[model samples]
Target: MQALGPWLPDDPALPPVALAVSGGGDSLCLAWLARHWRKNLLAFVVDHGLRAESAQEARLTVQRLADMGVPARLLTLTTLTKGPGVAERARQARYAVLAQACREAGCLDLLLGHQADDQAETLQMRHQAGSGPEGLAGMAWMSALPDVRVVRPLLDVSRQALRNTLRGAGLAWVDDPSNQDMQAGRVRVRHSLREQDEREALWRAGLQAGAARMRRDDSRTMSFARQGTFRPEGWVCLGPVLPEPEDLSVLIRCVGGQIYPPAPAAVRRLQAAGQEATLAGVQLVRWRSGWVLVREAAAMDAYGPAYAGARWDGRFELFLPSSVSRESLQVGPAGFGLDRTVRGGWPARFCATLPALWRHGQRVGIPHLGWWAEEALQGAGFLFQPPVPATGGGVYGWPEARGAWFAAHHI
Candidate 1:
């Protein structure tokens, strides 16, 4: 429990916690700990449905938890499909299922049972992939998972100790056969670590190095950039001086609303262009003072008129409240095309992508810019709220690396 202290909420008045239990030794151990820690807890067994035995395994996991008086549910992943990178895709689908369940259940934090062996394997993989400090640091104890906080309280503990606890309690766990697959890099790495004399030392050094790397990452800040502006409308502009590689990757993701960063080669090309260019669905322009990045208007998908909840280019959330009949009203792009009369002073490229209200194919209003036709319909206005950052960390605005370093190195 002392090992779990650093990752838990400071408030002892605990909220109901959720755990992702896979019927495996590590996760089942977590189930036991969660039951001991909090009287109010929820456990989920994610059935990836990739194998014939998976469904039975989930049922058994639920029964075991029920025996312990801990209510558990089996969430099945139904959208799985056979394909290349099936394992990776299944992993993502599993997390998506878990995250959605947590949100619906109002559980802000979700616990996992990753331990020392998993940590070492992750670092080994990252090192082989030529990862930088951030990637080499391996997984953090706490990470932003869309809407839920993913907490790994057992990162510092060993897999052997967890299994020992289960053994002492007379608890049995399923051994997933995938763990022994020699073809998989992770399994191979795990086996190699077991035979290595320096395994313990390697794990310790990696954790210490990872901690140092995280401290450096947490200390990163926006202070170094000449100017940086992140708008509520999902556009950002950075200064004449380009951001560091790490910061630039995050910036691209934020403006593009993409989960993955632009390819390294693509980013390097953009940096060298120093002019108008587009990458990862984000447009980069050279403003007088510095550089500006915005979502590419041409790349946006068109939104036809709908009854309610109209979104523009997946960038803004739009809601139109009306008492009158909405059959005649339609929402579409504000065109700056030929013969179109658009109020000037704004970037023509950006204005074309703004949400426009129309009536019988006639332009009526440009909501975000506050433009309305002389005789516009009543009870009609534009209110758009961008979705909150799915993952909360030092990615956007100021980097937390500076703060992390200060806390670690200060007198």
Candidate 2:
């Protein structure tokens, strides 16, 4: 509870804090601990529906949470099916639903129950996969998502310790059979860490790596603040010289609206190829003085229905007034043939990647450029809301690093 201080808020009048309780021993124990720490808490139990008993387990989890005096909701994923990369698919779906639920519930922080054992396994798996230093850090105590902040309070606690806590309270938890499946990479790593010495060594290594990552992130944040200029049109302007690979990668992720940055080697290659190049859905072009990093127009998302709060291209968000009719309205890229006079001197390539409102195949609005087809469409707006921050997500649990990050990003 003391360690969760930085991640949780003290104000009771604000929105409730959320928890991701999976009915497993680890999450159940987390819920149990959190109930005592705060009065206003919401739990979300996600049902992937990958097994015959998943729905039942979710329901039981909800009931258990209710018994503990914590309100909970069951989120059932219907689109996921068994296939290649099913585990990754399920994980992504789970987070998406969790984030959506948090937004609807007015929750800012979502607590996850990733314990020390899971962290050790992640470190081992990433080591085998040739992951970089950031990957070797395993998981951060706090991570920023597009819709919410993910906080892992039990990252320092062992799995067995959580089960022991539940047992001490005379509580029972669901045991998922999939955890023992040998075909899974994490399961194999878990089995291999049967020796206490090996697990401890890996856990220590992850902690050291996390500390190093925090330092690097601080330097990157400083570099971005001094040398990077972020535009509201979803692009960036760099200083005379390109930033280091780590700082450049952060800029690429922000401009490209990608959840993860390009690999370190790929970023290095881009830096070496000083000429105009495209990597990770972003184009680095030479502009006046320094450089301009913009979204690759060719890789933008297809047209989608335009509503009051529609998000397009994962880089811009749409806002339409209630008086505006959404019928036949779609949001897509503002192509080259559109009126360039209203582009406010921004490059045509940059304007081509801007989100525009279309009606019956005609460009109706390019909000950022202040162009509209009619007076009524003037109320339409597009906000540059990229998937991740320009300075990268801050480190949690480390007060100095987290504070530095928050100050740098103005969060």
Worst 10 residues of 1 by lDDT: 402-411
Q: List ranges where model 2 is wrong by over 4 Å.
A: 6-13, 396-411
How well does candidate 2 score on lDDT at residue 234?
90
Q: Which stretches of candidate 1 lie over 4 Å from their true place?
A: 1-15, 196-202, 224-226, 259-269, 272-275, 296-411
lDDT of 1 by residue, 1-411 (tens): 444343346343654578999999999989997777766788889999878999999999999999876788789988898667777888878877887788777777788898767877887776676665556556667666445777787765678778888888899999998788787778887877764334545555565666665455544443433357775545667878776666666677666655456666567767766768888888887767778777777776665764454555544545665653567777776777523244455577767666677778877767566666734344455443332231244222111332321111111
TM-score of each: 0.75, 0.90
Please give the RMSD to the true structure for each candidate, in Å.
6.8, 5.3
What is the C-alpha lDDT profile of model 2 across 1-411, one tens digit per residue? 565445456566888899999999999999999999888898999999999999999999999999999899999999999988889989988987898899888899999998878877888998998777777877878887767888887776778788888888999999999999999888988998897667767877887788888888887778777778888889899977887777788789888988767888899888877888999999999988889899999999999999887778887877789999889999999989755578777778988998999999999888888888867899889888876776547463353332321111111
